[model samples]
Target: LAKEGEEGAVPGPDLVAAMAEQFAESANNVIIEEVNKGLNPGMIVLLVVATTLLLFFVGNYALYLYAQKTLPPKKKKPVSKKKLKREKLKQGVSAPGE
Candidate 1:
């Protein structure tokens, strides 16, 4: 294939046919071996992936719920800038005359 590219030759019909046959034979052998082993590697991999994703989603949801329940509720307060300034001025004021 490398020599073919160097020779400026594109894969013609015959080359395509031969390559297809070679790939098909290899694929058939792989399928047969997997069947003999009685364990579909592809299905196992897919199952593991699905299980991992499910666990991740469930775990995150559980953690979110747990955090919400354990955390303290915030106090409701009506804030005002004037109130804050008054508090600061109060802190700065002197008590008796010098």
Candidate 2:
């Protein structure tokens, strides 16, 4: 009967403290597990963003090169020293000397 009484004795404060500690540790482990489970989705999102930026830059570069190749060449203007001097004189501008 003494053994049974000892077994049935209410837990002391120390025992209660130990139980609380174990509960806290288990809760922490559960939270960590949940975070770990979400890691894969975070990595997938990172990969998708990187891929989108890469494609955008590549397409922009290709379009720029294509435009350069397809556009017509610009016409060259002929320069005349007499015309330039006349225009500058009319505009009240003068070159280095008379």
Q: Would you estimate the TM-scores of all the predictions? A: 0.38, 0.39
Q: In model 1, which regions exceed 4 Å deviation?
A: 1-37, 74-98
Put down candidate 1 lDDT per residue, 52-81, tens digits, no spaces: 999999999999999899989988897786
Cα lDDT listed for each candidate: 0.82, 0.85
lDDT of model 2, residue 44: 95
- Candidate 1 at 23: error in angstroms? 40
lDDT (Cα, tens digit) per residue for candidate 2, span 65-85: 998999898788987888888
Which pairs of residues collide in model 1?
Answer: none
For every model in order, what is the number of clashing pairs? Answer: 0, 0
State candidate 1's TM-score.
0.38
